[model samples]
Target: MTALSELNDDIVRSMSVGAVFSDFGGKVNSLDFHRTADLLVTSSDDDSVRFYDTTSAKLVKTTYHKKHGADRICFTHHPSSVVCSSKHNLDNSGEFLRYLSMYDNRCLRYFKGHKERVVSLSMSPVNDSFMSGSLDHSVRIWDLRVNACQGILHLRGRPTVAYDQQGLVFAVAMEGGAIKLFDSRSYDKGPFDTFLVGGDTAEVCDIKFSNDGRSMLLTTTNNNVYLLDAYNGEKKGGFSMDSSQNATIEATFTPDGQYVCSGSGDGNIHVWNINNEPTKVACLDSYIGVPTCLKWAPRRVMFAAASSVLTFWIPNDAKPGLESGGLNSEV
Candidate 1:
């Protein structure tokens, strides 16, 4: 087990894995945190979306999608509302885009247009609008206030979209190595800037903007992660996901934007310092099964990673004797 003192010299590491939640009974597809509450939400292959109390490690709420299920979910500014793309079964006809009320599990609105499954979804930082990327080769932008799609961008390959912190701009990465930046208000003008990463062979699986909105994280199916300047698309260095056996990994920046963390197919969670010389600081094997979804709290030093099980992470100083809770196990 590597402690904060051993890995970064004298940097005083303030982070560690805290709790393990595995009641979902299936693979967790996504994980998200509430901006103002100590609550977290997860969507899973069990055909359910679950709410958990971060502090108590208790189940707060559960909503079932049954046949079609839910995936790629994001919470809106509203406390009781969330938008999630439907996960359809083999015989289903059309996919549904839903605005669901967590209070009663009621469907508020449905926006339908994608020709295939929606693989990615992201809510705006400052508004009720959201975006979805699909295998159908298109990106759809919608407003919660309206039931219809407000705008759409047609691309050549699979797309993953994310919004900047201010909701002023968004980035779209397709099957090719190209990443396009668009103005939130006028996206139809097409991307004002584009960055080509790797070569034409690198297939990007996910993309996220830092909380500070200055740098972007791009994860590829080829076991690579790239960090790029958000404004100019300059290739600012990156770290490789080579250690992990998982071909598809999701990497994200901590809330403070000082570090980067990613999940491994070997069931280990790796954190790296992005400042100064970028290097791996810690690796935590929290007994998870191929952690696919990872999220950091908006206002705290804590983060949650999900797979077949869900793990809440906090500073090691927060829990002294609990290190034996299996956090010390190497991946």
Candidate 2:
């Protein structure tokens, strides 16, 4: 067999289940892992945010937001702090964005501004500041210490936002395949660089930057995932999904930036070797339902994907070498 095919075979052989969380009663809408901990936070249609200890696969804490159901959940810089966007209160007295202390499920702050449902949320790598994108055609920046938006970018269509690893720059993807990059220090000055993705592809559902801050991934509703040079906006490659499925497939880059993993409506997880020629490396099947959220651990040989269940994939007998940096955590 060719060398590429052999590499694919080896990867498929090494990857296996490291942990499984099957307690989610409804579909998992979003998931985020702590940067340096063995913990995972998940928001589900069950109107709760659950935390799992990756090593033990135990649900450590569950925070239920009943009236304004939880949707996009993410852990801020603090291990005990979480930010999520949910529906308004049944009494029409609250906001869609909330910051909570996960330890006791105490609501610490509420960011109110978006008139429509918030579609996306991302935490900055360096601070308590975070960004939220909404179907209201705006992307707002909020600080955990405040209850109001620090800044807002009004767009023509749905907006998806991401911050670089250093929190030095941020990218915003909006309608008509437009990507605008702004400096975190002075975002109000407008984009310093802009890139336009051309093709039949349209709406961008999610945007993420590689851990190294050198590359970007844009997953669109058109069943296409585009990999771009994060700095210059040059297109590096693109991965195609089965358009027949018509689901919002979330794709993520491994911490090493060598591969990309995504979920399919076919109830399977797909991995691609992007460091070489960007080919389909493997497909893991037999999932109970469509896995909508996929995230790679920041410093481990493992990654996690969620459907109604949370599954962690790790390379068997994998050792951290000179390249992988080191083990992420004790987990």
Tell me, by TM-score, which candidate is best: 2
Give the Cα RMSD of candidate 2: 5.2
Model 1 — TM-score against the truth? 0.89
lDDT of 1 by residue, 24-114 (tens): 7688888778777767888888989988766555677988898768778888888778888887852354656888899988989888888
lDDT agreement of model 2 with the native? 0.80
lDDT per residue as tens, model 2, 4-32: 22334466547766556777778888999
**Model 1 residue 1 CA deviation in Å:** 23
Regions more than 4 Å wrong, model 1: 1-14, 89-93, 243-247, 320-331
List, in order, the clash count of every candidate structure.
1, 0
Off by over 4 Å in 2: 1-13, 88-91, 244-246, 317-331
